[model samples]
Target: MIESARNLDALKRRLASLDRVVRTRHAHFPFGHAPLDRMLGGGLARGRVHEFFACEGGEAAATGLSLILARLAGPQATTLWLRPSAAARQGVPYGPGLTALGVDPAHLLIGVMQDEGMLLRAAVEALRSPALGALLLEIRGRAPQLDLTASRRLTLAAEQSGVTALLLRLDADPTASAADTRWRVGAAPSVPLPGNAPGMSAFDLTLLRHRGGRDGVAWRLIWDNERGLFGDGRDERDDHGRQGEGREGGAPLSRASLSFPAVRPAADRAA
Candidate 1:
């Protein structure tokens, strides 16, 4: 009887493991941007470390990138935002916007490192913890080539422990390591929004890279700081937009034409 009971327990454990694998395979962030979410193969998974390497030349792009991190952190989940103090204080006042989105401000653990090594190490360790829902590493400029092995280990750790880490950095850095998804963001001044007043905060959000697809598809969005929400941008020239996704007259929103808007300054631009 005891042997049978032990076997049953093992079987239950196995089933649980299998269930997790199935779920992790389709990890995603529900950012309310269907087009953007669809492009990400259903958005970023919880157990995987997805890095965003930001490219140069655009506030629309940069702001959109910050929103991506904020979205992954979710409305109310524990987050560990690791970066330098100066970055946390001056360059980006990102936490307030996150709180505005409904996240528990107190639950956030903003860690500042004296050196790069400590920062990366803390990042690796943080992902290993079960309490954290997401780990965000904001890089202001180029991604330095510190230790590939270490980076790989961190990636493996995230996968093993079922935690998500986002290595957010600039695009100009040619030496950055390969990531699950690579994006080049830029601000397109002319991008339009779908609803409300035309001039209400907005940006040109481009999806520069997907795991397995062509690049250069993007979205234009209207960002309203007063109300922390993003909506589609309606441009007449952008005949295919969120407005006309299905109906005959509806503009067919392309991966390129649609915009993903976000409220201003998640903290300040890191550099």
Candidate 2:
């Protein structure tokens, strides 16, 4: 009888260890930005809900940044983006533009809901799918349906499924929610390329709230589409006025530079 009891305890311990390993694997992934990752306690947490609010005239920037993050979160997994039908007025996603941003259009699925209620319902349901890599819910204006209770529900589903949830809010103010992190995203001038060409996409990001870390920090990030990563928006130039190796903590842009074309997806321009 003592031998059997010992064996049972060993099994229990083994199971517990396995659980820990699984949780660790799904904990978080590095944002590739040194300072930002350090501030986030290693990286952005997976299997949790995060909120991104768009500043004035920055709806496109917020959407673009969120999509980039979703791709990073689950590069091999499919991402489903849910939006209300009314959002069609802003503009639908453009395929070429998405490709230029380093996100493969083939792995993305767009779902247009009839109203906010249906959109939230679909978001919760999508969060329950373990196969899904990331889920993005684009809510415009005041979203009453996404209350504290609804956010909690989404969080629970994400925990069970190990999927990251990104909420993009346009024309809305921050409200109470169970989000792990809240950010305000706006467009920033990009570095001009040779021959006065438009450079990569840039964003001015502000961390409004972080659940277990510091907040009210800001960072300027430049998206490197070719590498599918983000830089510190400090692009170095060589002697010939060509681009050089980029490093963090470089000098900020001195003058107004070009930004991404306004014809991209989720942009303010009419489709």
Candidate 3:
């Protein structure tokens, strides 16, 4: 009888492992942009690390990317936001701000740590928890612990738990990473609404890197916070009624149109 019980336990463990693999294999979130989604081979892979960095005058855009993903995780899902205490003190997410960003304040849990080591340890632990829907780690410039090895470890943990991890590197140049996708987000001026009201926040998102896809692609999208989706600037066109600059008929701009180099800043144009 004891032998039979042991075998049953082992079988249960195997089933659980198989379940994780199956879920991870099929999990994905579509960005709702056809060209970008096509380039992504469907959509963003869940259970993987996606890095978002800011370009010149684009810090808010990077945070917007993370928040949009969190919204995609489902309404009931909770997000674990881990950052250094210093960063938190600088500007923590408040209830009103989260509402404006279309994220539920109640669904967010902010964890403030002392330094990089503590923050990363907390991130790993939080990522391994299956209850958390997503993990967001804020790295100031290049946090020492965010090196390739550590990123891989976090990626594995996310894969095992089927949780999505986003690394937000503020004011940092893009570098090689173990993340599945890398994006450089830049802010775009919003379209003016009636009565000169400010419209939805827009972003110029450049795909800097991907594991098995093309890079140096860019898209101009506006965030519809209420719906939690990015919109192509279809309603707003140039004076000629054409789509807009740097894009073709609301489609993502190709690498050639981006002009700037991916993975690093371009050299001085005048130099």
Candidate 4:
């Protein structure tokens, strides 16, 4: 059994190496924020997996970030989201919720897997599929199947298929991962509104790990779901729908507002 395991490990390493050498046209998935893009060395590279973790009471924030990225796949593109059966029992993604989050329900397919192993398997297969524009896997806690080796396998599949993969790790501590970037997300206090109404959701994001990039940088960002973009409370659009260029006093200055630029799907780009 030991020898067989060793052989399998070696085979996986070889496959990973081979996958790295396969030449494919990779495009940048920019966050539309100048400072964040600069920190990311332009932007998150496609054909790679990004890992996101949430602190206590921040599950919604982390999922929001992932969904924002998934929206970058464009309206016509297909996105696959996988979650464990346990998570499905508590919070299954529905069309209304996703629509409220600025994601088109028709473009997303949600899968509830029986266990971590099945979830990872489905994620890997979806990552390898050329038809999918993006893949998202959400896990609530630590799972043995999500170790470094398994992560590398998923990474290799993503690279080969040129599909973007996002892993949302909820209520978990940081650990070794093969993902290109890792972020820790926490809910931030929202701005107060008139009539004691609730304001937009905000998130405090920390760059925990990034391949070939600096870490420890943090930002408090607000998501404009209606616009399908992120904003830093700089200014509001005028009545004509044009955003004004001005910073708020005593407000945290966001480097730049993110604009949802059109990024063609991988197959379309390859064509």
Candidate 5:
């Protein structure tokens, strides 16, 4: 048992030393998308921060994003849902949706705060402790007036402690951030039917920014509404998120079969 434990520790140490692993890759959890993992060189760099900005008025992208975060949250790590707007927490069925993504409600620490500063404080607090896996902050159209000095300080603290900080800004401006990696996700066609049937609600994950990777051409993903799962695509081979090089930039968009509700713009009527 002692020998086994020592081997495990050594492996963990190697994983911890991964430059990107600290922000995205962690042993406990798997990447949201297998393809995305390839792009991330594993997964979201653990102990690093990734900022997701939802400029779209509605959270048409949220359902898919939820699954991503849930996948990132390992069994041992905790997800701190901080300062969600009324629509996000009360109006939208987040807990249920998250449950569908395999994230247990019991493991989520949701806090409804009134201001952005409080949310920042919570991020700082969560980063102070290495036990945390990921922190998801749902902002209500916030201004990007956070202290950069403080944010940099927190980044350093996260490096020392080993925690991933995720910022989800709904209906917020894209320029309102100074994070490590920034991304924007939108709803696309889910899984296509057997034949002429329409596809369900799926996602189009756009990599707005990455530390070291090519930009442009978003990855199209299918969403499994019932099972709360994400499908790779019409093709079976590429379960991973690999960019098809020869494929044209703007592929013809197939119309979806299911009729999902129109998402409203993200507003700031939070707790």
Candidate 6:
């Protein structure tokens, strides 16, 4: 037993050394929102772990924003999304709706794990793969399994593989983790279209924590599905109802009275 323990320790040391040597330079992607992007020092860092926590009644907004980030992080690569089987009751990703959000549903691979343990294990493995451009782990509630150690493991894997990892926590509070950034997301009123129709997906995002930057900053972002980017919540409408130059300190939009469903059933034909 002592000999076996010694070998295990030696193996761990070797793995740690390998991890240090395999570090890849982290990259950043712009959110397209000038203020937010500037605050993020160009954009959010890639090849790092980021956490998004959903506020009450904002589960859908959190999920939507996370999905958008995943797509942006790996526009040309496949994204692996891991979730617990229990989340199926909430809803599945509607392919058509995802397409409407500028995310190619075909490039997204969803994995339904039996439990949180399995889901986290799969997330770590997925993050370690260089072929995967991004990984999203949807853990509803307080995920006890995703402790600091587990987060560190995922971060290390992402750093080595150059894959961005996103953690979406539904109905959960923030906890200790190795994530490079953390956010609180909620639904915001979207700018109405010409005929009072839904203009674009909007979100209220609060930067709860940033590893090497400022935090506690809040922004209202509008997701432009056509451009596949985000805009500052400025009412910049032209005569043709098109977006114009956004100015700072614009009037705040009214609170989102409309409900936006975050996830829809894949079986829903109406989607």
The RMSD of every model to the true structure, in order and in angstroms, is 11.1, 12.2, 12.1, 11.6, 10.0, 9.3
lDDT of 3 by residue, 10-54 (tens): 323422332222233456787666656777887888889999998
Each prediction's total of clashing residue pairs, residues at least 3 apart in sequence or on different chains, is 30, 0, 0, 0, 15, 1
Model 5, 41-64: lDDT tens digits are 765666666777664743646634
Q: lDDT of each model, Cα atoms only?
A: 0.51, 0.73, 0.65, 0.66, 0.53, 0.73
**Over 4 Å off, model 3:** 1-26, 232-271
Query: Distance from true position, residue 50, model 1, in Å?
Result: 2.3
User: Which residue runs does candidate 4 get wrong by more than 4 Å?
Assistant: 1-26, 192-197, 232-271
Best of the two (1, 5) by TM-score? 5
Question: In terms of TM-score, how similar is model 4 to the real structure?
Answer: 0.74
The candidates, ranked best first by TM-score, are 6, 2, 3, 4, 5, 1
TM-score versus the correct structure, for each prediction: 0.63, 0.80, 0.76, 0.74, 0.66, 0.80
| Candidate 5 wrongly placed segments (more than 4 Å) | 1-35, 58-60, 63-67, 84-94, 176-178, 190-201, 223-271
Query: What tens-digit string does per-residue lDDT give for candidate 4 at 1-271?
Result: 0011012234233233322223235476766556677778767888898998988877777887787787764334666677777666564454444565677766666666777887787778667666666777888777777999999999999888888899999878878989999988776665554676556656677888889888766766666677765664442322122223232343434332222211222333322
Model 1 stretches with alpha carbons more than 4 Å out: 1-26, 55-64, 73-75, 89-96, 99-104, 146-148, 174-176, 187-203, 221-271
Poorest 10 consecutive residues by lDDT, candidate 5: 1-10
Worst lDDT run of 10 residues, candidate 6, spans 1-10
Candidate 2 local lDDT, 1-271, one digit each (tens): 0011012234233223321112237478766777678779877899999999999999888988898899888886667787787675557676666777777776776667777887787777777666667888889989988899999999999888788999999999999999999999888776678997887887878888999788877666777777777764463222222223233345444322325542343544333
Worst 10 residues of 4 by lDDT: 1-10
Model 1, span 217-245: residue lDDT tens: 55555443444445544421122234444
